[model samples]
Target: MKILVINGPNINMLGIREPEIYGRETYDDLIAYIKEETKLLNIKVSFYQSNHEGNLVDKIQESYGKYDGIVINPAAYTHTSVALLDVVKAVGIPTVEVHISDPDSRDEFRKISYIRQACVTTIKGKGFKGYIEAIEYLVKHHS
Candidate 1:
Protein backbone atom coordinates (compact mmCIF):
# COMPACT_ATOMS: atom_id res chain seq x y z
CA MET A 1 0.00 0.00 0.00
CA LYS A 2 1.10 3.55 -0.69
CA ILE A 3 -0.27 6.61 1.08
CA LEU A 4 -0.09 10.28 0.32
CA VAL A 5 0.01 12.83 3.09
CA ILE A 6 -0.98 16.34 2.04
CA ASN A 7 -0.73 19.42 4.22
CA GLY A 8 -1.82 22.83 3.05
CA PRO A 9 -1.28 26.52 3.69
CA ASN A 10 0.77 27.70 6.65
CA ILE A 11 1.25 24.18 7.88
CA ASN A 12 4.90 24.72 7.08
CA MET A 13 4.77 27.17 9.97
CA LEU A 14 3.35 24.69 12.44
CA GLY A 15 5.76 25.02 15.35
CA ILE A 16 6.58 28.71 15.08
CA ARG A 17 3.14 30.20 14.51
CA GLU A 18 0.97 28.80 17.29
CA PRO A 19 2.48 26.77 20.03
CA GLU A 20 -0.81 26.63 21.89
CA ILE A 21 -3.08 25.31 19.18
CA TYR A 22 -0.67 23.84 16.68
CA GLY A 23 1.91 22.81 19.26
CA ARG A 24 5.61 23.65 19.13
CA GLU A 25 6.65 20.95 16.73
CA THR A 26 8.27 22.18 13.55
CA TYR A 27 7.19 20.84 10.17
CA ASP A 28 10.36 18.73 10.07
CA ASP A 29 9.56 17.32 13.48
CA LEU A 30 6.06 16.42 12.36
CA ILE A 31 7.39 14.81 9.19
CA ALA A 32 9.85 12.77 11.19
CA TYR A 33 7.07 11.62 13.48
CA ILE A 34 5.01 10.49 10.54
CA LYS A 35 8.01 8.68 9.09
CA GLU A 36 8.60 6.93 12.40
CA GLU A 37 5.00 5.78 12.55
CA THR A 38 5.06 4.63 8.95
CA LYS A 39 7.89 2.21 9.64
CA LEU A 40 5.69 -0.29 11.46
CA LEU A 41 2.87 -0.13 8.96
CA ASN A 42 2.72 -2.22 5.82
CA ILE A 43 2.76 0.75 3.48
CA LYS A 44 5.09 3.19 1.78
CA VAL A 45 4.28 6.86 2.32
CA SER A 46 5.00 10.16 0.62
CA PHE A 47 4.46 13.58 2.20
CA TYR A 48 3.83 17.00 0.72
CA GLN A 49 3.08 20.48 2.05
CA SER A 50 2.49 23.76 0.29
CA ASN A 51 1.17 27.18 1.16
CA HIS A 52 -0.56 27.37 -2.20
CA GLU A 53 -4.09 26.09 -2.76
CA GLY A 54 -3.53 25.35 -6.43
CA ASN A 55 -0.51 23.19 -5.66
CA LEU A 56 -2.46 21.21 -3.12
CA VAL A 57 -5.32 20.78 -5.55
CA ASP A 58 -2.91 19.58 -8.19
CA LYS A 59 -1.33 17.14 -5.75
CA ILE A 60 -4.70 15.69 -4.83
CA GLN A 61 -5.65 15.37 -8.48
CA GLU A 62 -2.33 13.64 -9.08
CA SER A 63 -2.96 10.93 -6.46
CA TYR A 64 -5.35 8.79 -8.53
CA GLY A 65 -3.52 5.52 -9.22
CA LYS A 66 -0.28 6.72 -7.65
CA TYR A 67 -1.56 6.28 -4.12
CA ASP A 68 -4.00 4.08 -2.29
CA GLY A 69 -5.06 6.34 0.58
CA ILE A 70 -4.59 9.97 1.58
CA VAL A 71 -4.20 11.56 4.97
CA ILE A 72 -4.84 15.25 4.55
CA ASN A 73 -4.70 18.27 6.79
CA PRO A 74 -6.13 20.93 4.53
CA ALA A 75 -5.45 23.57 7.19
CA ALA A 76 -7.28 26.81 6.41
CA TYR A 77 -8.45 25.41 3.11
CA THR A 78 -10.67 22.92 4.89
CA HIS A 79 -13.40 25.53 5.36
CA THR A 80 -12.99 27.35 2.06
CA SER A 81 -11.61 25.48 -0.92
CA VAL A 82 -14.09 23.80 -3.21
CA ALA A 83 -11.37 23.26 -5.81
CA LEU A 84 -9.35 21.16 -3.39
CA LEU A 85 -12.44 19.19 -2.44
CA ASP A 86 -13.24 18.64 -6.10
CA VAL A 87 -9.80 17.15 -6.77
CA VAL A 88 -10.18 14.82 -3.81
CA LYS A 89 -13.53 13.75 -5.22
CA ALA A 90 -11.98 13.21 -8.61
CA VAL A 91 -9.18 11.10 -7.18
CA GLY A 92 -11.73 8.94 -5.34
CA ILE A 93 -9.32 7.63 -2.75
CA PRO A 94 -10.05 6.82 0.85
CA THR A 95 -9.12 9.97 2.78
CA VAL A 96 -9.02 10.97 6.40
CA GLU A 97 -9.13 14.62 7.40
CA VAL A 98 -6.75 15.60 10.20
CA HIS A 99 -6.78 18.70 12.36
CA ILE A 100 -4.23 19.62 15.00
CA SER A 101 -6.82 21.49 16.94
CA ASP A 102 -10.49 20.62 17.17
CA PRO A 103 -12.26 22.83 14.67
CA ASP A 104 -15.43 22.62 16.72
CA SER A 105 -13.65 24.26 19.62
CA ARG A 106 -12.24 27.09 17.55
CA ASP A 107 -13.80 29.99 15.71
CA GLU A 108 -17.29 29.51 14.31
CA PHE A 109 -15.86 29.74 10.83
CA ARG A 110 -13.60 26.81 11.54
CA LYS A 111 -16.59 24.79 12.68
CA ILE A 112 -17.92 24.56 9.15
CA SER A 113 -15.96 22.35 6.75
CA TYR A 114 -17.04 21.31 3.26
CA ILE A 115 -14.33 18.67 3.16
CA ARG A 116 -16.02 16.76 5.96
CA GLN A 117 -18.99 16.29 3.67
CA ALA A 118 -16.76 14.16 1.48
CA CYS A 119 -14.48 12.52 4.05
CA VAL A 120 -16.11 10.33 6.65
CA THR A 121 -13.22 10.23 9.13
CA THR A 122 -11.98 13.46 10.66
CA ILE A 123 -9.40 13.26 13.42
CA LYS A 124 -9.09 16.36 15.53
CA GLY A 125 -7.50 17.68 18.73
CA LYS A 126 -4.94 14.88 18.82
CA GLY A 127 -2.03 16.85 17.45
CA PHE A 128 0.33 14.75 15.31
CA LYS A 129 -1.18 11.55 16.62
CA GLY A 130 -4.15 12.26 14.38
CA TYR A 131 -1.87 11.64 11.41
CA ILE A 132 -0.79 8.34 12.89
CA GLU A 133 -4.34 7.23 13.55
CA ALA A 134 -5.52 8.21 10.10
CA ILE A 135 -2.77 6.21 8.40
CA GLU A 136 -3.39 3.18 10.59
CA TYR A 137 -7.11 3.23 9.88
CA LEU A 138 -6.47 3.59 6.17
CA VAL A 139 -4.27 0.53 6.36
CA LYS A 140 -6.92 -1.44 8.22
CA HIS A 141 -9.80 -0.25 6.07
CA HIS A 142 -8.27 0.20 2.63
CA SER A 143 -5.01 -1.70 2.32
Candidate 2:
Protein backbone atom coordinates (compact mmCIF):
# COMPACT_ATOMS: atom_id res chain seq x y z
CA MET A 1 0.00 0.00 0.00
CA LYS A 2 1.06 3.59 -0.54
CA ILE A 3 0.25 6.59 1.62
CA LEU A 4 0.72 10.29 1.12
CA VAL A 5 1.41 12.31 4.25
CA ILE A 6 0.41 15.96 3.96
CA ASN A 7 1.18 18.73 6.42
CA GLY A 8 0.11 22.33 6.19
CA PRO A 9 0.89 25.88 7.36
CA ASN A 10 3.40 26.19 10.16
CA ILE A 11 3.90 22.45 10.53
CA ASN A 12 7.34 22.96 9.04
CA MET A 13 8.05 24.94 12.17
CA LEU A 14 7.76 21.88 14.37
CA GLY A 15 10.08 21.99 17.39
CA ILE A 16 10.50 25.75 16.90
CA ARG A 17 7.14 27.47 16.70
CA GLU A 18 5.69 26.16 19.96
CA PRO A 19 7.67 23.53 21.72
CA GLU A 20 5.31 23.64 24.69
CA ILE A 21 2.57 22.23 22.56
CA TYR A 22 4.37 20.73 19.57
CA GLY A 23 7.33 19.21 21.37
CA ARG A 24 11.06 19.52 20.84
CA GLU A 25 11.36 17.28 17.81
CA THR A 26 12.32 19.17 14.68
CA TYR A 27 10.35 18.57 11.48
CA ASP A 28 13.16 16.40 10.17
CA ASP A 29 13.11 14.42 13.38
CA LEU A 30 9.42 13.73 12.96
CA ILE A 31 10.05 12.56 9.38
CA ALA A 32 12.81 10.25 10.51
CA TYR A 33 10.65 8.87 13.26
CA ILE A 34 7.80 8.10 10.88
CA LYS A 35 10.17 6.41 8.44
CA GLU A 36 11.81 4.33 11.11
CA GLU A 37 8.55 3.27 12.68
CA THR A 38 6.90 2.33 9.41
CA LYS A 39 9.84 0.84 7.51
CA LEU A 40 8.97 -2.69 8.46
CA LEU A 41 5.30 -2.32 7.61
CA ASN A 42 5.90 -2.83 3.89
CA ILE A 43 4.05 0.26 2.86
CA LYS A 44 5.43 3.11 0.80
CA VAL A 45 5.06 6.55 2.37
CA SER A 46 5.48 9.91 0.69
CA PHE A 47 5.49 13.29 2.46
CA TYR A 48 4.54 16.81 1.40
CA GLN A 49 4.38 19.94 3.55
CA SER A 50 3.70 23.56 2.73
CA ASN A 51 2.81 26.82 4.38
CA HIS A 52 0.88 27.72 1.23
CA GLU A 53 -2.69 26.49 1.19
CA GLY A 54 -2.84 26.33 -2.60
CA ASN A 55 0.26 24.17 -2.77
CA LEU A 56 -1.31 21.76 -0.31
CA VAL A 57 -4.49 21.66 -2.32
CA ASP A 58 -2.46 21.04 -5.46
CA LYS A 59 -0.61 18.20 -3.82
CA ILE A 60 -3.84 16.60 -2.67
CA GLN A 61 -5.29 16.90 -6.16
CA GLU A 62 -2.12 15.48 -7.64
CA SER A 63 -2.35 12.41 -5.42
CA TYR A 64 -5.50 11.34 -7.24
CA GLY A 65 -5.16 7.67 -8.20
CA LYS A 66 -1.48 7.71 -7.23
CA TYR A 67 -2.00 6.94 -3.57
CA ASP A 68 -3.93 4.30 -1.67
CA GLY A 69 -4.54 6.51 1.36
CA ILE A 70 -3.63 9.87 2.87
CA VAL A 71 -2.56 11.06 6.29
CA ILE A 72 -2.98 14.81 6.69
CA ASN A 73 -2.17 17.30 9.40
CA PRO A 74 -3.71 20.48 8.08
CA ALA A 75 -2.53 22.31 11.20
CA ALA A 76 -3.96 25.80 11.28
CA TYR A 77 -5.75 25.18 8.05
CA THR A 78 -7.70 22.45 9.79
CA HIS A 79 -9.79 25.13 11.37
CA THR A 80 -10.50 27.19 8.26
CA SER A 81 -9.86 25.54 4.90
CA VAL A 82 -13.03 24.36 3.34
CA ALA A 83 -11.01 23.96 0.15
CA LEU A 84 -8.94 21.23 1.71
CA LEU A 85 -12.04 19.46 2.91
CA ASP A 86 -13.63 19.78 -0.51
CA VAL A 87 -10.64 18.43 -2.37
CA VAL A 88 -10.32 15.51 -0.05
CA LYS A 89 -13.94 14.65 -0.67
CA ALA A 90 -13.54 15.16 -4.41
CA VAL A 91 -10.49 12.92 -4.57
CA GLY A 92 -12.38 10.27 -2.58
CA ILE A 93 -9.20 8.74 -1.23
CA PRO A 94 -9.31 7.24 2.25
CA THR A 95 -7.91 9.99 4.48
CA VAL A 96 -6.95 10.26 8.13
CA GLU A 97 -6.43 13.58 9.88
CA VAL A 98 -3.66 13.93 12.46
CA HIS A 99 -2.57 16.51 15.01
CA ILE A 100 0.34 16.67 17.41
CA SER A 101 -1.80 18.36 20.02
CA ASP A 102 -5.41 17.71 20.84
CA PRO A 103 -7.28 20.62 19.36
CA ASP A 104 -10.39 19.95 21.41
CA SER A 105 -8.32 20.62 24.49
CA ARG A 106 -6.72 23.76 23.16
CA ASP A 107 -8.03 27.23 22.52
CA GLU A 108 -11.64 27.54 21.48
CA PHE A 109 -10.57 28.63 17.99
CA ARG A 110 -8.52 25.49 17.56
CA LYS A 111 -11.47 23.27 18.32
CA ILE A 112 -12.71 23.30 14.77
CA SER A 113 -11.49 21.00 12.01
CA TYR A 114 -12.97 21.75 8.62
CA ILE A 115 -11.35 18.70 7.06
CA ARG A 116 -12.53 16.18 9.62
CA GLN A 117 -15.80 15.71 7.85
CA ALA A 118 -13.92 14.18 4.91
CA CYS A 119 -11.59 11.91 6.83
CA VAL A 120 -11.81 8.28 7.88
CA THR A 121 -10.65 9.23 11.39
CA THR A 122 -8.91 11.94 13.38
CA ILE A 123 -5.86 11.15 15.49
CA LYS A 124 -4.81 13.74 17.98
CA GLY A 125 -2.75 14.26 21.16
CA LYS A 126 -0.52 11.27 20.53
CA GLY A 127 2.23 13.49 19.22
CA PHE A 128 4.28 12.18 16.27
CA LYS A 129 3.07 8.70 17.06
CA GLY A 130 -0.28 9.78 15.71
CA TYR A 131 1.16 9.60 12.20
CA ILE A 132 2.18 6.02 12.73
CA GLU A 133 -1.22 5.22 14.16
CA ALA A 134 -2.87 6.77 11.14
CA ILE A 135 -0.66 4.87 8.71
CA GLU A 136 -1.33 1.65 10.53
CA TYR A 137 -5.04 2.34 10.62
CA LEU A 138 -5.11 2.81 6.86
CA VAL A 139 -3.04 -0.31 6.35
CA LYS A 140 -5.38 -2.36 8.49
CA HIS A 141 -8.70 -0.87 7.44
CA HIS A 142 -8.47 0.93 4.12
CA SER A 143 -6.33 -1.63 2.33
Candidate 3:
Protein backbone atom coordinates (compact mmCIF):
# COMPACT_ATOMS: atom_id res chain seq x y z
CA MET A 1 0.00 0.00 0.00
CA LYS A 2 1.16 3.49 -0.77
CA ILE A 3 0.29 6.61 1.17
CA LEU A 4 1.02 10.24 0.46
CA VAL A 5 1.41 12.67 3.33
CA ILE A 6 0.92 16.33 2.56
CA ASN A 7 1.55 19.26 4.88
CA GLY A 8 0.65 22.85 4.11
CA PRO A 9 1.32 26.52 4.91
CA ASN A 10 3.60 27.19 7.86
CA ILE A 11 3.87 23.54 8.81
CA ASN A 12 7.57 23.62 7.95
CA MET A 13 7.93 26.02 10.88
CA LEU A 14 6.48 23.52 13.29
CA GLY A 15 9.13 23.80 15.95
CA ILE A 16 9.35 27.57 15.89
CA ARG A 17 5.84 28.67 14.89
CA GLU A 18 4.00 27.95 18.15
CA PRO A 19 5.70 25.59 20.53
CA GLU A 20 2.90 25.87 23.04
CA ILE A 21 0.28 24.46 20.69
CA TYR A 22 2.25 22.40 18.20
CA GLY A 23 5.00 21.27 20.56
CA ARG A 24 8.73 21.59 19.80
CA GLU A 25 8.93 18.89 17.18
CA THR A 26 10.62 20.05 14.01
CA TYR A 27 9.05 19.11 10.67
CA ASP A 28 11.82 16.53 10.22
CA ASP A 29 11.02 15.18 13.67
CA LEU A 30 7.40 14.78 12.64
CA ILE A 31 8.48 12.90 9.52
CA ALA A 32 10.76 10.65 11.54
CA TYR A 33 8.02 9.90 14.03
CA ILE A 34 5.67 8.89 11.26
CA LYS A 35 8.33 6.76 9.60
CA GLU A 36 9.16 5.00 12.86
CA GLU A 37 5.54 4.26 13.60
CA THR A 38 4.83 2.84 10.16
CA LYS A 39 8.14 1.07 9.58
CA LEU A 40 6.77 -2.31 10.59
CA LEU A 41 3.47 -1.90 8.79
CA ASN A 42 4.97 -2.58 5.36
CA ILE A 43 3.36 0.42 3.76
CA LYS A 44 5.12 2.67 1.29
CA VAL A 45 4.87 6.24 2.50
CA SER A 46 5.89 9.51 0.88
CA PHE A 47 5.76 13.06 2.19
CA TYR A 48 5.35 16.53 0.73
CA GLN A 49 5.08 19.95 2.34
CA SER A 50 4.41 23.26 0.66
CA ASN A 51 3.40 26.74 1.66
CA HIS A 52 1.84 27.29 -1.76
CA GLU A 53 -1.77 26.32 -2.40
CA GLY A 54 -1.24 25.59 -6.10
CA ASN A 55 1.70 23.34 -5.41
CA LEU A 56 -0.35 21.38 -2.93
CA VAL A 57 -3.18 21.10 -5.44
CA ASP A 58 -0.71 19.88 -8.03
CA LYS A 59 0.59 17.28 -5.62
CA ILE A 60 -2.89 16.01 -4.94
CA GLN A 61 -3.56 15.92 -8.65
CA GLU A 62 -0.35 14.02 -9.18
CA SER A 63 -1.29 11.51 -6.50
CA TYR A 64 -4.26 10.37 -8.59
CA GLY A 65 -3.55 6.71 -9.28
CA LYS A 66 -0.17 6.61 -7.58
CA TYR A 67 -1.27 6.59 -3.95
CA ASP A 68 -3.75 4.46 -2.09
CA GLY A 69 -4.42 7.01 0.60
CA ILE A 70 -3.49 10.47 1.81
CA VAL A 71 -2.80 12.02 5.21
CA ILE A 72 -3.04 15.76 4.94
CA ASN A 73 -2.49 18.67 7.28
CA PRO A 74 -3.64 21.67 5.31
CA ALA A 75 -2.59 23.98 8.16
CA ALA A 76 -3.82 27.50 7.48
CA TYR A 77 -5.41 26.36 4.26
CA THR A 78 -7.67 24.03 6.19
CA HIS A 79 -9.92 26.94 6.97
CA THR A 80 -9.69 28.66 3.62
CA SER A 81 -8.85 26.52 0.61
CA VAL A 82 -11.74 25.31 -1.43
CA ALA A 83 -9.26 24.37 -4.15
CA LEU A 84 -7.82 21.74 -1.83
CA LEU A 85 -11.24 20.31 -1.10
CA ASP A 86 -12.07 20.18 -4.78
CA VAL A 87 -8.82 18.56 -5.86
CA VAL A 88 -9.02 15.92 -3.18
CA LYS A 89 -12.54 15.18 -4.26
CA ALA A 90 -11.48 15.04 -7.87
CA VAL A 91 -8.63 12.68 -7.12
CA GLY A 92 -10.97 10.36 -5.23
CA ILE A 93 -8.20 9.27 -2.91
CA PRO A 94 -9.12 8.14 0.57
CA THR A 95 -7.84 11.05 2.62
CA VAL A 96 -7.44 11.63 6.32
CA GLU A 97 -7.10 15.20 7.49
CA VAL A 98 -4.64 15.75 10.35
CA HIS A 99 -3.73 18.68 12.57
CA ILE A 100 -1.04 19.03 15.23
CA SER A 101 -3.30 21.26 17.27
CA ASP A 102 -7.04 21.03 17.68
CA PRO A 103 -8.70 23.58 15.51
CA ASP A 104 -12.06 23.15 17.16
CA SER A 105 -10.60 24.40 20.42
CA ARG A 106 -8.93 27.38 18.80
CA ASP A 107 -10.42 30.51 17.34
CA GLU A 108 -13.73 30.49 15.47
CA PHE A 109 -11.95 30.72 12.11
CA ARG A 110 -9.84 27.69 12.90
CA LYS A 111 -12.95 25.67 13.55
CA ILE A 112 -13.67 25.59 9.84
CA SER A 113 -11.98 23.07 7.58
CA TYR A 114 -12.61 23.34 3.85
CA ILE A 115 -10.86 20.03 3.24
CA ARG A 116 -12.64 17.99 5.89
CA GLN A 117 -15.65 17.49 3.70
CA ALA A 118 -13.47 15.50 1.29
CA CYS A 119 -11.64 13.44 3.88
CA VAL A 120 -12.55 9.98 5.07
CA THR A 121 -11.55 10.91 8.63
CA THR A 122 -9.89 13.69 10.58
CA ILE A 123 -7.30 13.48 13.37
CA LYS A 124 -6.20 16.42 15.48
CA GLY A 125 -4.71 17.57 18.78
CA LYS A 126 -2.59 14.45 19.04
CA GLY A 127 0.67 16.17 18.16
CA PHE A 128 2.99 14.33 15.77
CA LYS A 129 1.32 11.09 16.75
CA GLY A 130 -1.73 12.19 14.82
CA TYR A 131 0.10 11.47 11.56
CA ILE A 132 0.69 7.94 12.76
CA GLU A 133 -2.96 7.52 13.54
CA ALA A 134 -3.89 8.80 10.11
CA ILE A 135 -1.45 6.52 8.32
CA GLU A 136 -2.53 3.46 10.30
CA TYR A 137 -6.14 4.24 9.64
CA LEU A 138 -5.49 4.41 5.89
CA VAL A 139 -3.53 1.16 5.85
CA LYS A 140 -6.19 -0.63 7.84
CA HIS A 141 -9.16 0.77 6.01
CA HIS A 142 -8.12 1.84 2.53
CA SER A 143 -5.41 -0.69 1.86
Compared with the true structure, what per-residue lDDT tens digits does model 2 show for residues 1-143? 99999999888899899899999898999999999999999999999999999999999999999999999999999999999999999999999999999999999999989999999999999999999999999999999
Model 3 residue 70 distance off true place after TM-score fit, in angstroms: 0.4
Candidate 3 residue lDDT tens string, 18-126:
7999888899998888888899999999999999999999999999999999999999999999999999999999999999889999999999999999999999999
Q: State the number of backbone clashes in model 3.
A: 0
lDDT of 1: 0.90
Model 1 vs truth, CA RMSD: 0.8
Error of 3 at 5 (Å): 0.5
Candidate 1 runs further than 4 Å off: none
Name model 2 segments beyond 4 Å from true: none
User: How many steric clashes between backbone atoms does each model show?
Assistant: 0, 0, 0
**Angstrom error at residue 44, model 2:** 0.4
TM-score (C-alpha) between model 2 and the true structure = 0.99
Q: Which ten residues in a row have the lowest lDDT in candidate 2?
A: 9-18
lDDT of each candidate versus the true structure: 0.90, 0.96, 0.95
Best by lDDT: 2
lDDT of 1 by residue, 1-143 (tens): 99999998999998899788888999999999999978978689999999999999888888889999999999999999998778888889999999988999999999988787677599999999999999998999988
Model 3 stretches astray by more than 4 angstroms: none
The alpha-carbon lDDT assigned to residue 60 of candidate 1 equals 85
